[model samples]
Target: MEWTGARYADKPTVEVRTWVNATPERVWAIVSDVSLMPDMSDELQAVQWVDGDRPAVGGKFVGRSRHESFGEWSTTSHVIEYEPGRTFAWAVADLDRPSAIWRFRLSPKDSGTQLSEWMQMGPGRSGLSYAIDAMPEKEQKIVFVRMREFEQNMATTLAHIKKLAES
Candidate 1:
């Protein structure tokens, strides 16, 4: 099966935002720790240490998560950019698709810290990714649905982190 790009039902991209009642440093502590993701995110089941320093630019890690129909999926991320208490980004690779990117940004605010995550799929290409994309429109919708789920999961994670930091 070949999943041509046409499978997408023209759904708008998904984005979610959440704020934490902790300083950037505090938030960074939780986000930068790749080993703790499974404990933080409701969707992400586990993260295995791949390489590189904690949250440092060039760091690599693999994470596993479950989607509605996909069951369990794994993706690896490489830290392309890192700024202490400001911004951190990861270019995801070696999964169902090769051209996906996930990034996280941290900004300080009067209340605490603002954290955001974003992901983009396709255009890069991989045999498996293309094969999966070949499925029907409903299958294509899973990715978007997961993105939204991640947002809410992340929001809850942030809220927990906030409580931990404030404590």
Candidate 2:
């Protein structure tokens, strides 16, 4: 991700994909369980369903994340898209006005499933915006570094999911 001077308006995204030697059902089982996400992520420390027992659209969840540079924070996310064995997506913070959108997609392969994890940064206020506001001159650099961090973390997350699904 080269510098595009991406700001909140740019809504930049980072995605990582991998093929797992498992059925779509198997992969979906792992991805749908938001509670398991922390075990697969670098920044996320925990997640809990807010009021619903299932991953249906409109359901909410709270996630706690710890970042080395940014510190720890929590956010409530609303399930925006939920299709069992195919896709799961959520919007962080306000559903009508999200700070970010995150998704997990699964597709059937010959003997396995292709799984992808993707996330798009905000077009609204978020932790990043606070940092940018404090150091307006280095906005591009800050966004770039954060995007890279997201990329690496997403890749690691995919790898962990693949391992779990295959085993």
lDDT for each candidate structure: 0.65, 0.90
Candidate 1 lDDT: 0.65
| lDDT string, candidate 1, 1-167, tens digits | 54333333232234456777788888888767777767777667998767544677777888887755556778777787788777776766743334556666888877788877665554454223444566645455555554566567756776666676677
RMSD of each: 4.9, 2.0
Q: Please give the RMSD of candidate 1 to the true structure.
A: 4.9
Q: Candidate 2: where are CA atoms >4 Å away?
A: 1-3
User: Can you list the residue pairs that collide in candidate 1?
Assistant: 3-133, 3-134
Q: Give per-residue CA lDDT, model 2, range 52-145, as digits (tens).
A: 6579998999999998878999999999999999999999998777999999999999899999989999876788888999998778888888
Deviating ranges (above 4 Å) for candidate 1: 1-13, 51-53, 94-99, 125-134, 137-140
The per-residue C-alpha lDDT of model 1 at residue 47 equals 85
Superposed by TM-score, candidate 2 places the C-alpha of residue 72 at a distance from the truth, in angstroms, of 1.2
TM-score of model 2 vs. true structure: 0.95
At residue 92, candidate 2 shows an lDDT of 97
User: Residue 68 deviation, candidate 2, in Å?
Assistant: 1.6
